[model samples]
Target: MTQHLANFKARPVACVTGATRGIGRDIALHLAAQGYDIAFGFRDEIHASNLQEELVALGAKVFCQPLNLFDAKSINSFFDSLNTAQFGLDLLVNNAGITKDNLLAMMSQEELEQVIHVNLIAPILCAQAALKIMLPQKQGCIINMSSISATKPNPGQTNYAASKAGIEGFTRALAVEVARKNIRVNCIAPGIIETDMVSDLLKGNEQQAKSKLLSKRLGKPRDISALVAYLASQQAEFISGEVFNVNGGMLLR
Candidate 1:
């Protein structure tokens, strides 16, 4: 704790999307513990309140708001509030995403569009907003939450995989564009994390999932959060436009 305080005289601010639960919540808390003022969005007011209390307890200045990723207006409004509140975001974590599982043949247009809207389009918009603030400061970090599915997708995840793959490409392009400006962009590809997002999938197949990974264990939200903290720090100042795999070696045999 003391070390974290020593690292920053003034706490940096981070805006995280989909922070009501699961990995997003964990990322918000982890950044708070590291002495960052947290500004996060949620679809549920109840979840937002709970997370606000927790972040406040950690000595972080917390700003919680309702966000609808499906609506472009809502995305714009979120950043508007952040700017109005003078939070001056130093980090933006594009962790808000949804999965609408279905094969190409069975998938409805609405379902596919919804997934793409939330998972891919929202991040691009948020990054655009954050840059307005960051470019002036000439320092900021943006971490997009990608997935292992982008490369090794499972059945019925066409929409999810495509959105994640888009994020990787966006991360690379943006990183290069912002390199000279001192802003950084990166992506995190998590595999089979033990979050509510996949609780059902892991219920009866825990052992089966474990057997496939060299670590023989599922990844945790904390696992990804720790890496996010590092990337946001000076240690990773030279690192950008890279997609990091945090899947307990799930990609390997």
Candidate 2:
């Protein structure tokens, strides 16, 4: 048992939210391949279970739990359970986010608050929870997912943009607060990725969107996942409090 505990402590762990699909799923898989045990939370139990099996098959110990981003109680319970797990957390990837796009004039209060709760509030809470464990260990890495919309807003995306912009600001501020403790915080702003979440946005304007990208193609989850892996690695130890863009050159700012 002592040897087993030592082995468990030797392997790094990563907790990824909304990790059953899209960019979140890719990040979890990429990290598992890099030898990190995975702990993931998702709203869909069946999907999360299947993903757990897949990750386990990849030779990484996997943990899956239910998460309701709308519920603060649920978020707290998740981190509490994670802190008790055998694998110690060394990285956190806040990949879960939602967008309710509508012109401000037509947007209902419910829509605005829901988007803000999931995109901005929940991530902030998760980061706080992770810091509880990370600070004691004197090391950890946090990667928050932002979007191109955060900087370049399109019509009918005011709430979405605002929430993401908050993510960038929070990431920067938190990085400073935790840098002295050996914790690195960073943000990623992805451009038009070909995920189901954005399928509608690309429906009739696929060609038009492609034209705007210097790469002339939509970004893939792998593109973002690769960068995430780099940031979580020791090579990026000097990098923190910065936002990296994987937008296929769609925006130059």
TM-score of each: 0.95, 0.95
TM-score of model 2 (CA atoms): 0.95
Candidate 1, residues 1-253: lDDT per residue as tens digits? Answer: 1101122226899989988889999999999999998887776777888888888899888766677887778888878877765557799999988888998999999989999988999899999988988887888999999999999999999999999999999999999999888999999999988898688767888999999899988888999999999999999988999999988887885
Segments of candidate 1 deviating more than 4 angstroms:
1-9
lDDT comparing candidate 1 with the true structure: 0.87
Poorest 10 consecutive residues by lDDT, candidate 1? 1-10
- Each model's lDDT comes to 0.87, 0.87
Model 2, C-alpha of 10: deviation from truth (Å): 3.4
**Per-residue CA lDDT of candidate 2, range 81-123, in tens?**
7676635689999999887889999999999999999999999
Off by over 4 Å in 2: 1-8
